[model samples]
Target: MTRRSASTGRWTGSSRCCPLKTRPVCRSQNPRSSNEPLAQGSPASCTAAVPGRERKSRQAGRPDVTKLLVLGAGGQVGWELVRSLQPLGEVVACDRRRADLSEPATLGALVADVKPAVVVNAAAYTAVDRAEQEFDLAQTVNGVAPGILAQAARSAGALFVHYSTDYVFDGSGHEPRKESAPVAPVNAYGRSKRAGEERVAAAGGDWLVLRTSWVYAARGQNFVRTMLRLAAERESLRVVDDQVGAPTSARLIADASAQLIRQALDERSRGSFGSELLHLCAAGETSWHGFAAAILEGWRELAGADSLKLRELAAIPTRDYPTPAARPLNSRLDCTRLEERYDLRLPDWRAGLMLVLAELARKD
Candidate 1:
């Protein structure tokens, strides 16, 4: 089954990668086993076979298949994960309906049932401002649930992957924050996410926590889409310029995750796998006001200046635009560790924004 993306108008496979009701268990025909040694040479060469490893599956005959369970399949990053993880293994993608993170107790049963080789949790309570009033709900979903999921994955001998945010930091310094930096979340949402990270770590499992900043995608409610919508409605826009960070796309995050998964699986088989936290985001940075300008600029280049009502874009400091939640000024996350470890070179924020804008333009 397939569904059309509202933003891009492109047909994409359904969230469920395999029919769990009919098949019960889905497996890919990828010939490479977890125990197989990675190809020699650069990391690029080592992972080059990941997307096409299934070509020789028929010849190899019933090769080992990795079953991956992805939660929050309806989300932007989760949606992309369903597509990107297909080549790596048999994916059992579950939206909130199938796996509700709000009810953490139920997750163990689901994990036990699927018995996946890997468990990726992309679900979270992301309403930053609303979380101020509903901190309990946010904590239940973001904080408690991930720990439960991680523990379940540990019991099942499955590698657990979870996503965090730069909001975990207090945003005091101007420098890009390393993974080892002290965490001091400034808002309720950040506190909840920080709790989730600590819980996942305490669960004692082979887990990976990827901390990212300003995530957006073509097919979701994101900064890029929101900017486009506002441009179409308002003649002039006032955006906050104080907060700065890289606007990482969901597609990039999913693709990089698949690559990391492939490497981790190989290492796991060789008894060299270890749990770690890493920051992943696009290269470079920009303020929200700058990001808004870029979005409008990209839209104008793609759809023409006459297509938007946005004329003047004004920049204001955080003090000028106050909210219920206190936002961190510095949201930049250092990706040097992720880059060196995975041998991956992340694209610039502008490059990613342009690609999303182009996708949105295709729908028009």
Candidate 2:
């Protein structure tokens, strides 16, 4: 469905490609007048200015209030980012309707019109198997659009933040991969994401590329929710045991991003801000079979055993479950750089799982 902005008289494209719907603009700490509508443009814009309030000096250890633009605002991470980033400054959140990634040409205009201090892109073409048949579409949204956004951010003098995946590595070694590790993607989706990373880096300004693995949330279509649905429908299930990675929560990623953005802003104030590429995920690792088992176990604890029909959970190798794209056997990523630079400690995978399960339980 297409939507036209009342002020711009421009049509926002359909949501056929984008999975998430647009969320309302979040103005938690916004200094702007409550009745003033958001600025009309390609991606939409929100001003941070208060009509009569005087601008504060930065010398008092307080960063200047800035405007932040968040693309993919309807996504799992994007949804949380709207909430998490609200305290930082004025948040202009956009979903596919406000900012369509497939139309790369329009994206530059969106950034230019917004002229935000920070640009966070959480939207992506995440269909792994489908990407094999729709490589061009995936490449356009996941690969091409990011470069344009990064360039726009550079031109606008804004910090660009993008998320990547562990699939960039060809599942060769058993150990976790460092940010410096060589990349050789085995699937189309991975190739597109890798291409995005390369392009973002090539654009070169204040930028950050965070690589994460097995992301999930209380909402959205992810492995955790899929397992829960399947468990209630089937008596037994089979999951691949060969592939392993951390099950990072969208909430964790959002919170960490806020912290990173805050630090980046502080460093910028001190003229020490620099671009970075880091791995961000949960602390530990587990195979898909193990993750499924843990998910069921946690669900049972929260919703009781009768809530699911699942009786047996079978573990099988990757070969037994062939797909349109090959998955990385070793999806591990070493987040030492992130930890050291940010002085943050990531929680274990199970801890994150339980929190999500509890949220789901409360929803029920």
Candidate 3:
């Protein structure tokens, strides 16, 4: 498929090359409007910007050890980022309380005040089903806020890193979607996220948008948590079998973000850093039923003979379980661009799932 550059209005096919970065792009090229009302959140209460010491640190050619700002420090990926980003710099982590994406205007101000050398936006409006009802709020938070953050990063001369979803695709074919593939989001949430991607690209900054799928963590309310809770309370469980994607762990995503951030910082030192979108998810794919089964089997082994009363597991089609929002049947993503550029590759889904199971067992 031919990849069109939203920045340069040029086309490139199948090559690992980037479009020429001439100047800051305009707003009309972006389909999403930034004038939407902000999502619900208070303005930033940070009085002083980042300390002067950090500014000096940037000039001394040691920006890696400078201030690294991360938005959404409370979610699964955000929680892991606190620890993962420490190696790169003095991690100034902000949850919704500190830096809320819903309050879009505040984000730009907060970013400007903080003046971070690197900005990683892990925060997003991820309520897939609820997004159908709150389309405006979702678009405001997921779409406009990212563009605000990206522009702030540009003004502060910081590299922007954002996360996206496989939902950007319609999920028609069994093959993994590449970065160059045409996007056709089926649900409101997907449309909002895709809008965020466009806005970020149009902002014309040094940015990296990592698109992942089926994300879960040891903490937070994810698929694994839901399955475990249901298994303990019910006699059986029914999971959809038609949908397929890699179950990417939050820890893995955090680690990969750190790696990519480090590389971006290193490139900046050489007076150059380019922006590109890439896929970053666990290797291989499986249906939701298969993922649930693996989680249960792993938990059973860890619990010895005293496992949950999960007597039976049933696989159902997507049509059998209607939801407020439609889910893509295929969430698989091709990560060749990521692997080739960063010399990085994720481990298989099973390996990461085992680690998560082990962590959960330890907590118990």
Candidate 4:
């Protein structure tokens, strides 16, 4: 365990491979425009700015320690961000309730007060289906908040770390979408997220947008929990099989984000630039049915004598699965950029699921 400072915002870590340095980034506050209109897509130069951070990360040198402030302390990603940012420096985790993202002035004030070395925004409008009807709220939270946050991070000389979704890309490509691929989101949720990405890039902030898919954790309400509950209650459970993607664990993403933030902050400490968009998810993929099967398998193996059977899972097509928002049939993110840059390895979906499953079972 790393020991963190109570007042100076300093931290002491015992990690040999990564004993991060800690310090405040800057003291300036980010300002906002009075228009209060919604920010839109990334332009040519901005959108295309996702050059590999790995390109600049080759020269290895110990970066100074930095203080980090994480927005959205309540969400799944935010929860883990709190754990991951420990070794880096003093971490101040906040959410909409703790601080206001809609009130740009408040956000700027918070940044100035925090004086963090980095800001990781894990907060967002993740209500995929509900986002269609709740466009305004979604846009406000996911789209507007990010731009505001990015500006704040940049103002504080903080490297903003962010998380995005696979929905940003309209499911039209055969291969997994790359960081540079053109995005044409079909739903309001996707549109809002894409808009957020664009705004971050356009604002010219030192940032990294990690677009992930099917994120789940034992603590939150996710697909795995839903399936397990349904399987036990109903005789048969219908799951979409046509839509395919990776089922990433919150733990995995948190760890990866930690590693990436260390590198990014290291660069910032040495006064170097870093990459913006990086895909961090598990390896391989699976349909909803496949995921259900794995969950059921976990249930049976570890589930108390009262768990459901394999016969309960009914494979269904995407058309039958109706929701307020449309999901991507191909959410396979081309992780080559991440793999090559971080030179990191990700376990398969099943492996991550198993870990989550075990955690869930322990609780159940």
Predictions in order: lDDT: 0.74, 0.76, 0.74, 0.66
Give the Cα error of residue 114 in candidate 3, in Å. 1.1
Model 3 TM-score (2 dp): 0.85
TM-score of each: 0.83, 0.85, 0.85, 0.80
> In candidate 1, what are the lDDT values of residues 245-349, reduced to their tens digit?
888888888988998998898788778888999999999999988888888888999999899997888887878765667888899999999888877888888
Alpha-carbon RMSD to native, per candidate: 12.6, 10.0, 10.9, 12.8
lDDT of 2 by residue, 6-56 (tens): 110111111111111111111111112324332223544433222222225
Ordered by TM-score, highest first, the candidates read 2, 3, 1, 4
Q: Sorted by lDDT, highest first, which candidate order results?
A: 2, 1, 3, 4
The clash count of every prediction, one per candidate, is: 0, 0, 0, 5
Q: Which window of ten consecutive residues has the lowest lDDT sum in model 2?
A: 12-21
Cα error, residue 324 of model 1, in Å, equals 0.6
> Across residues 174-224, which tens digit of lDDT does each residue of candidate 4 receive?
688888888888888789888888888877868998998877777655566
Runs off by more than 4 Å, candidate 4:
1-65, 304-306
Candidate 1 global lDDT = 0.74
Which lDDT tens digits does candidate 3 get at residues 144-179?
989999999988888999999898999998999999
